[model samples]
Target: MWVCLVVSVALIVARLALRKVRGQKITHGDYWCLCAAVSIVGRLLANHFLLIYGSTRILSAERRIELLKPGFEVQASEIITGSKLVLATRSLLICVLWSLKMAVLDLLARLIMKMPYERKLLYVFWTALFLTYLASIIPVFVGCHPFKKNWQIHPYPGDCVIGNVWLFTYEVSNILTDILLMAVPFSLILSVRIPGMQRLRLLFLFSIGIFLIAVSIMRIVQGHNSRVQSAHTLWASLEILFAVIVAVTPTLYALVRNRHENTTYDKSHLSMGATARTHPGSLAEGDRYAARVWTELNDSASRTDTTSIEGILVERRYETSDVKL
Candidate 1:
């Protein structure tokens, strides 16, 4: 998770630099990616605290007794029990997920053909994401009588929502959002005619949504059956990492493109190879050669500012009108 977060930040910075050098304005997607990065860092902070003071740790007898007291006066600041730890984790994870979602959605809005009818539908989809964010978060606070009661070391079950109900709602909605974000864009991708390889790349990028769903499903399975706190924490962190990865992946491919573009050796050899492979019955090689050259040419074609940032890897306008949507 930490590695993914670091890579995400690095890519965002590099992408922004690329945009600046090209004299393009920073975009909504970029802003959302920045927000996503911040939320991811926030999630990491929550994860660190979970490892140190969350349910996974062994508590002292004295500490346990102190926490269990009726008049102990526990507040949100304290993290003595499992409830507080889980609450904080849930809250932060939801924020991270939604920030990434908005980033991705904004980027897609630019890429997907912008017909008024389609735009209305897209707006509706964006609203759904926002509502999903609310559904995942609002309950974390209000599930208990007093919001602080959620994290308090109550003697027994206080006036809180049933655990089963909370879990089912949160998990189902989360899973639903995960599925929708990935599945809805299929038609849009198919709408724009592109080359086989680029189409494949887009499909692969969209497939990250499937991975997100898989992780979410795994989390549900692990959460339902596992009794170990450590294992639970690990699963939770893994999900967050996957979310960050999906969010950052769109802009990331450009880095690979940039490396090939910047390498004098590769460019020189590519030209030499292109000339050598220009024989009859070498149509396949010609296409491959053309693809590489097109990638380079395409990179130079984008006159607008489109920094690589956004979730679902669905940001950056056309990734130079060819490497992206």
Candidate 2:
């Protein structure tokens, strides 16, 4: 996750710096991605701590806990560690997931910001997501009858029935949200009359959200496996990590597209130079023009200003949703 975070931060910084040079307003989407990077770092640290403490449970009660009987034993330390891991996982997962969704969604918002109806729909989407995030997190803090029931060991005054139902519901919601986010961008793209290659790239980028849905399903299937808490934490981190990868892909693609455009421009200029050299009277003039052209190209290519490099990305012909703002 942190790897993803670092790459994203680097890209966004490059993007913002380029935009600044071009005198373009740095969009909210850039800030959203930055926030997502920070959230990824937070999740990584929390999960790292979780893995260290949770892995301590690898020892059976005999070694790690006080053995009181052949069938049953108790360890206060293990219980405390278990409680911390559970609470940490429960609380932090939502934050990581929410940040990931917001990052992806905000990018879409920037892409389609000029479309009034769609932008309003995004407002609705953000509100619903915020509400869902709250709903999902509130229960972890307040669901238990006495609150301590959340981490209480076995031998409750009565039977201690663990709630697998909520777990399944949470997984389903995660899958549903991933699907929703994936659909929005693709649905909008479908209406645009872009060239086939650009359309394919857009589809590919948005389709990455499917991986998040797959990870959510796997997480549900792996529920409550006590044998390896570290494995569980690893898999959970991957859900957000997968999103980080998808979120960074489009920005990186812009850089690639910019390079391709530069190559094309240089080739065209070289062809013009060759044509000029073909005429005897124009040879000297052509040589000077070509020299000047080469100098300009070299200067522009050497510039690290991200916006001018990626200007074509902002002006892609298929941005039917574009507004002046």
Specify the highest-TM-score model's number.
Answer: 1
Candidate 1, residues 1-325: lDDT per residue as tens digits?
A: 4665566566666666765665456667668777766766776676666665544123334565666566644422345554566676677767767777776675455444322244666877778887877787778777777565554543443435223345555667777877767764565555443456666766787678777778777777766634355666566566666766666576555444444323432332344332333333223432332211111212322212232211111111122223211
Instruction: Estimate, for each residue in 107-166, the C-alpha lDDT of model 2 and write its tens digit.
Output: 666545433355577877788677777767766665556766655544341212233444
Task: Give the poorly placed runs of model 1, Cα more than 4 Å off.
Answer: 4-8, 11-14, 55-85, 158-167, 225-227, 254-325
Per-prediction TM-score, please? 0.66, 0.64
Cα-based lDDT at residue 210, candidate 1:
76
lDDT of 1: 0.55
Measured on C-alpha atoms, candidate 2 has an lDDT of: 0.54
List the pairs of residues colliding in candidate 1.
104-311
* Residue 322 shift from truth in candidate 2, angstroms: 19
